[model samples]
Target: MAFFPVFWRILAALITSLLIFHRFSSAQSWDPGYTFMHQATTAPTVAFYDYIIVGGGTAGCPLAATLSQNSSVLLLERGGSPYGNANITDLAAFGAALSDLSPTSPSQRFVSEDGVVSARARVLGGGSCLNAGFYSRAGHDYVRLAGWDARLVNESYQWVEKVVAFQPPLKQWQSAVRDGLVEAGIRPYNGFTYDHLYGTKVGGTIFDRNGHRHTAADLLRYAKPSGLTVLLHAPVHQILFTSRGGTRPKAHGVIFTDANGLSHRAYLKRGSNNEVIVSSGALGSPQLLMMSGIGPIEQLQAHNITVVLDQPMVGLGMSDNPMNAVFVPSPQPVEVSLIQVVGITHNGTYIEAASGENFAGGARTQDYGMFSPRIGQLSTLPPKQRTQEAIDKAVEDMKALPQSAFVGGFILEKIMGPVSTGHLELTSRNPNDNPSVTFNYFKDPRDLQRCVDGIKIIENVIESKAFSSFRFDSLSIVTLLNMTASSPINLLPKHANASRSLEQFCKDTVMTIWHFHGGCQIARVVDRDYKVIGIDSLRVIDGSTFRNSPGTNPQATVMMLGRYMGVKLMRERHATNGPK
Candidate 1:
């Protein structure tokens, strides 16, 4: 065979192998003897099971897999299957779709409503299959403070690491910004490793295998259990519950509509005592709950949604990490594309992990070293109170370090930006209606100030002699000030501007990086066990339950929560009765 043909054949085989691996890895139980019978002659009636899990995405998949080990599990997903779809499993193809596909396209969007768009994946594996795999555990102190039992959370983290099979990228590429850090004197600092914090002047590492991205689908699909039944293309409209006389309400089943728009009800077997766990992510879980009368009374009433439980906190405490892209001219072209420089707490990660304790008790524990001390300090402040002074100090600290010897070949520049706080709200009562997601990016005055501080620090670093050999653009503070003034009230303090002249030069250059989270916050709607407050047999195990947004990619934390919650559910069930 010709060399080109040989290479093509090898590539094709590798892709096929990866797809097969992903499928088998996510399959927890697959019983050849078990079969789903559809009554063709009659209207689809409620079918019973021991557990009903909504949203077969990242968290839901793991939860279903874990629960199905000993119980009859029904995994309901609103979107269609992702397996065997070239558009989904193919990374290059998926990236293209991200740019051109319609916002309503299930394979492309997070949430789209009222002209506002957020990143959401409606396919079988949810965001896990789509996200850039960067796995890091939630801060230890934050987890401890979140009122999560320390032992349980740690065990869950360990189990998650095993299940996800997280592996850091072998090749680390440095960007112009990272070079600017070296010139500015920033050195690579290897902080606590177990906490998954590796502070280098460059970007945070990725989780890839042999140059290909690994996803949650790769993990759960292979371990699919025979006892577990996954129903794809079935969107859950509402959770069905039953009242057991004066006691708390118990979720008994779910009402879902299939892709063909036919409604069906799945009931729990009598005396089997099933529970309904909602892991539809931050956007979907809260939205579904509110539609079923489980949210704020006023909001539900305004939408004419019948109030079921009057849970005021169903959709409250919406939060997310605001991200802005900074472009810098590189002295040389680079190979690595995505890099995360800083992962700050700013109340979101800490509050969610700590469970709403005071900052001292929440993030001030031993695991604090896992994060940038400067970023950690900023996280200590209320989002509104973070000032330029604090941001400047953190930047100064970063500038004082030396560049990594491993990444010395590239000419680096810096891209300093802001992290925004946002929330999600329902636009209509319809299940198909996408919710209104107001990221409120850069709305807070302090958030803007931090970006300015970050930019200034980057400029100082670039001016250092370490980077004198390389040629790059100098982003000035004046440009930040001017851009802040010229931008819209909601999108001001644009991070892309490198100079005051640049800000003036391109007044319409602001854009969003799209990292939204924290709508159905934890502790308020759901307890530490992930069980919905005041509702029995109902739990939420996804990013939506984050008490606050974690400052970095939320995939790892979401998976950890799923593992933790799944184990907790199993343990509790086992305590009451002998193991299955």
Candidate 2:
């Protein structure tokens, strides 16, 4: 009996082994969906490589992709591969898992001296991998007003669209607010055109086809080349510059720390005039520069670190889109919200929308906005003018509403507006230390006014005829009704008051959408070419380099800047060396 049992066990074990092998072999051939190929063998330690791009993110990925086709290139990322986590491949899973996996603890979040937390992303694909996939181009007018050559900007935008494969959502949900805006006499504009200037109007949103989010990682996957090497979980500590010709300082290599907290130095290949491109996103690029002794002289001196470059602008000009959300009860108690994305340019329109069915692949129909000088010039206006314009528009639209009509639509009023300037500062000498970020949100008087303005606009929209069908009641009314019915008022707080204005509701409930940018701004840290003023072979090509945050989501603009910088670097290298 014992011998027979042993024989059966052996047969079972063999069958299990064969089954496992078969499954494993099948998985190898099945598409993994997203690909992350890391080179196993380290490159030769000699200073080599035609280009060294840092961050492997929204910007760095494309930059390395474009440059590596014809040259030896090195791409370094501070986090592990995007595919390192299976959850990352699923859009909903990524969103659900992000909160837990985020590096900063809830207690250690970057708080300004005034006590406000600024959310930042630290991962292989950086913000692009984690962002809410809203792809918008830089308004042509905005780019032109930033003093970029029109021809160059146009070319760059085209290249970016081509490489990134921007797509719009297949189905769109029309918000009750859209009808309200039109009824309130606000002109309706197609929000996401390549040639249009995006306005304050609320009618543009796009999503991918599979109902999965389309991030920059998707675009970059296609651009990956064989020679390009991506190093994950490697955080660059500092750039080591080798002085050439006694006066000219050139970059030779970078020293970085791996995930295990061990340090390693990567040198440029021999005889290769390598350039280090930093696309570490808005928060990271500035942090890296400050750590490498390239920021404000006083701050560096305070840290007992030698200032390699006394660029005070390294952390200045910090800006981000102050976002707020309004949650309205669905009129029909729907399971999902359809998002329609639009950009209102002066001369063009861009529109994208997505329904639950196609959320994975993103929006199906995409329209590109054209270059327009008027829209971009808005940033150049005096701060007072900008504030007044935003406020007046809101007020004018609101004043036209009748009180009785406003209470009829989906009534949860969430307003996001009134952006505030912020700064990114190093809290410690350690590269791993989170920076002290101060948004000073709503600190500026103008920002407060803008928030108020946004609330008023919402109120006006609620009063319009388009919303009358939904039957949106005030919070007090809903609460009273619930109380009378002996039902739990779950959505309302116990401290709620009947006298609160919609504006007050907005103030108490709004939160940041996490679109930080504009610190380490262009023309401040670097010139038109994105090269740091005093450093050679070093440049910043990420959201941090924006002179001003465009009104739309910044992913497309960030990618465009990366492509632009990459092409320029390649062009310069070719011109100087007469083509590889």
Candidate 3:
């Protein structure tokens, strides 16, 4: 009897392991049928759909997928597909896409009017393809502020998680960072979770155990192939409107250009419920609207774009979270890793870190975007290349070094709910050109104070006992702030008083965490349901609708919003026209 029990136990364990392996393998190979996907050059000159979504990005992909279940959808992406793009799918080659500034690359470079370098996603998966892969849901207060239905929000988050989110395995550097955050008094340690909690915790990631990233585009696997059509490299020029002697303008179609520079038009099917949704990112949404003659009268006319509606608030209220970091060099090589651990403080400061030799791989030497501009004389590069250099330079320099001169990792701090705001305006009439936007980082005194407070916490972390081994020397806060070898960019003064130096540091070293949001904000550009206030059958449902960026990373909530809004639109249709 004892022998039989042992044999059964062994058999059960083997079966469970095999089942788990099978599940992951299936997920790895699963494919959404590609029959309906096409290059814009191959698309017909005219197409009609129940809904037309411009920008196949973080929110657009999922929204299109969800809507495809019950209606015909056209998803237009200005960039190429993410499928098989190793720079995007491989976690080790993380910043590769951002560094590739070619016209066809998946990341588009932009320089904010505040003089900060930044890039936006030009791929089907959007920022999900370019971010650090951290995945955490929005805070409870954020959900309430957005006026989202709690139950539906939870359901939508789960739907996205099942296909994309995963528990990140924390290696040595990340584990040490987590301990340091705790030792510095961030809070109780909450192990692996997706919830946005105020403490040092390991958050979910889109990267799998094998280090492959599953992006929002993966959600398309749930889409109905027959009902969805995704066009790659299709840049929408403007939304087309027809005036039937109505009080408000009605959007019925959009004119876009194909990869071959040929024009094409996509229209919504004739139905009271049909709509044109703009799921382009924060910058793109407002720019698209203005390009279509729906913005401030002076700005539109300045660009030679005809004015459709003088919506004065179209390009107002833009903001980006400012980030600062300290580099702790190690005597020994550390394992490569992206963001896995984070410390969320009560005052809305976020602490995170990443380490690995691959992160400092030699291939990125010329990538000004990922490294310090001082490293390769990148500051002297032409304006075009300089614009591509958006992320903080230390990290970028690390990736460029074949053999890193500084074998270490960075512990960074980013302030939340930034009070300072700016706006975006078209620089040219061409839809493909980058816009002139200013986040006006640290313009608000309160936001500057938050940065100072966050830096103090980081200083504590660097001095903590848990982080001692990673420090090659006794580097002071001021010295650490000036650690990077070269740069025309300003650094903290070595002898200034702590108070003055810290505040100045906040202004001088303020780099974007790439979490910019708000332009076409809710109540300003769109209604609660995301419908454009003065435009019938037109909506904007991306991060542009957020007054503040949600969660530590916005991808999860952005993706969830896609599904949530898709379901809401579906239910409304069902109630009005009956279920299909």
**Clash totals for all candidate models:** 51, 69, 13
Off by over 4 Å in 2: 1-36, 39-47, 84-86, 102-118, 149-152, 162-175, 191-207, 222-224, 244-248, 269-273, 342-419, 468-471, 474-510
Q: Write the per-residue lDDT of candidate 3 for residues 221-318, one digit (tens) a residue.
A: 88999999999999999999876765689899999999789999999999999999999999999999999989999999898888888999998999
RMSD of each: 14.1, 15.7, 10.4
Best by TM-score: 3
lDDT of 1: 0.50
> Residue 449 deviation, candidate 2, in Å?
2.4
lDDT of 3: 0.78
Which is the winner by TM-score between candidate 1 and candidate 2? Answer: 2
What TM-score does structure 2 among the candidates reach? 0.72
- Output the worst ten-in-a-row residue range by lDDT, candidate 1: 349-358
Segments in model 1 whose C-alpha atoms lie over 4 Å from true places = 1-44, 100-117, 163-188, 191-198, 201-207, 221-224, 244-247, 271-273, 340-423, 460-514
Q: Number of clashing pairs, model 2?
A: 69
